[model samples]
Each structure stands twice: as C-alpha cells, then as structure tokens.
Target: MTWQRPASVPVGQVWSRFKGRERDGQPAKMSNWERYIAQGVSLACFTETDGAPDELVAFNITLDLVDVFTLYGVDRYLTSSGLTVLPEHRGQNIGARLFEARKPLCAALGIQCTATVFTATASQVLASKCGYTQLAELSYSHMAARGVDLSGCATPTAKLMGTKFHFD
Candidate 1:
C-alpha cells in the first residue's frame, strides 16, 4: 500500500491510541502527542478508518537534534522511531512497508543517519531486521526530556549512519 505523511496532529492521535499511557501514567496529554508529531520530520504508514475495529499500522520518522549536531554537524537526521501495528495486524509486513516507503524520502533528504530508542524486544528485533545496528543501551532517564518513561522502560537505541542505504 502507498504511504503518506499525515499532519502531525492526526498522527499524534494515532500515536496516543497505541502508546496508551503517558510517562506520568496519566492519559496522554494532547500536547505531548502534538509535540511528537510536530517534531517528527516525516512519516510513512497507513491509518485505518475510525471505528473500523481494525489496527492502524504506521512508522513515524523523526530527526534527532542532538545526534544530528554531533554526527553530521546539523540538527536533523532521519529516524524511524515509532512503529506500531494493532495486535490483529501482527505478522503482516505493515512495518516493513512503512520503512520501505520512508527510505526514499530519507535518501532524497540526504539523511545519512537514523536513530531510535526502543523498549520492547520486538522493536529491537525489528530494528536489527531492518538494518539498524544496536549502538547503545542507555538509561531511559536520558530520554526523559522527551517525555518518555525512564523507570518502566529500558532504552535500546539503534542507528544507521554514514552514506549507507538499505531498504528492504
């Protein structure tokens, strides 16, 4: 299926539905969602119809300011951060599809690096499968400023840097 980047607000709503709780354990604030979507540089994924009883599968692409500055001397680099598929949609290639769709955009943007922090084993596996290498295992507190949960989540981040492009 073809993928497109929705406006950040709508993408945030989709993100909120999958992420469930905020770091504070409260229902996620709309502002946080808005922030994430706004911070996201690009997106490649599909959204299911509202009230369709189906899962919405999508991959969110973001640019990390810090990493971009450190590695590329810029404040932006492509990142595939949020990959969510409804339970029923598991085993399908939705995630891969999202990645494939986003790859070209990254290339066009001259994005030679990508980074992401993952808390789930499945996410780690997916990252490796998608050609990202485990670069660091750091404390979640490092990501706290981003509104992520430090205590409950184990932060595993991966990266694909330099002039390498692998789209599968």
Candidate 2:
C-alpha cells in the first residue's frame, strides 16, 4: 500500500500494471473517468509520527454539485470529489468517520445538502449509513453506451445519493 512510482516507471505505468487488481473482491482502483471527477477541495486524515502528521491515511474531496440541481432543486449543494482510504487502513471505520465529519463542514460552508454518484456498492452502503438516500440509479452498461466504460466494476449499477444537513 505504500506505493511509490519508481523513476523508471512511466507516468501511468504503475497504475496500468495494477489496473485490474482487486481487494476484498472489488476493484482496488478506479477508472480514469472517475479519476477526472476526483479533483477538488480535499479533507484528509493523517497518522501521527512523533506527534506530527506523517502519512495521509484517508481522504474525501468535495466539489460543487453539478447536473443534479434539478434533482435536489438546488444548484449549490456539495458533492463528492472522491473518497479514498489507504488499503492498509481499510475496515477501520475511517471512511465512516470522514463522512460524519462532513456535516459540520457543510454547515460551516452554508451548504444545506450534499450529493454524490456512488460508483461502488461499498460506497453506496457507506452513504446509506451516513443518512444519504438514493436519488437515482444507473447501470454501468447504460453508462457505457454514453461513452464511459464502467463495465468491470464490482457492481452492475451505480447510485446517486443525497442528504440534507441541519445546521443549528
């Protein structure tokens, strides 16, 4: 899990080499299309070494919600940039804690709702546990017809999930 792309490896060579790698019966890496959507404000958790953060263990990025204004009836909701936890840190509830932290963040940003397209079943489950409800669902096959291929994913379908945050 401590991956360092060696100088000899091409820019994406390491990723390409392990593109089909699976963990816990699911693909460990995301498709390039999904990677394109992962850019935005990042929230991260790091492990301390000598009382200073030394390694990023988990992270979730937030971006302005897009194309789903009609679904939530708002144009300014927060959405996922992407969420990831180091493979070594998996199964430790770190991902759930990150989602829980978003509530306070949303309130501070004056954003009332949050939404995301959960391309993995595990993420959809986590979203549900975080109180997000399914707003829509699309099959990977359907997405492929539109020019984005998500055929080799763990789940046949992806879900659009959303939730409203209450600020005191």
Among the numbered candidates, top lDDT falls to 2
The RMSD (Cα, Å) of candidate 1 is 9.6
Cα TM-score per model: 0.53, 0.71
Local distance difference test, per candidate?
0.50, 0.66
Off by over 4 Å in 1: 1-35, 47-56, 64-76, 139-149, 154-163, 166-168
lDDT of 2: 0.66
> Which tens-of-lDDT digit does each residue in 1-168 have in candidate 2?
222323442331111000112335322433343354233234566655575555455667766544446755665677775688877678777777878766756565556788888988899999999899999999989999999998889999989898987777
Clashes per candidate (backbone, < 3 Å): 0, 0
Candidate with the greatest TM-score versus the true structure = 2
What root-mean-square deviation over C-alphas does model 2 reach?
Answer: 11.3
Which residue pairs does candidate 1 place in steric collision? none
Please, what are the lDDT tens digits per residue for candidate 1 over residues 1-168? 323343422333222222221122222112233355555445533433574423224445465343443644545555655666555445666665555545565555545556666667777777677766666675556656578665664434333322245545
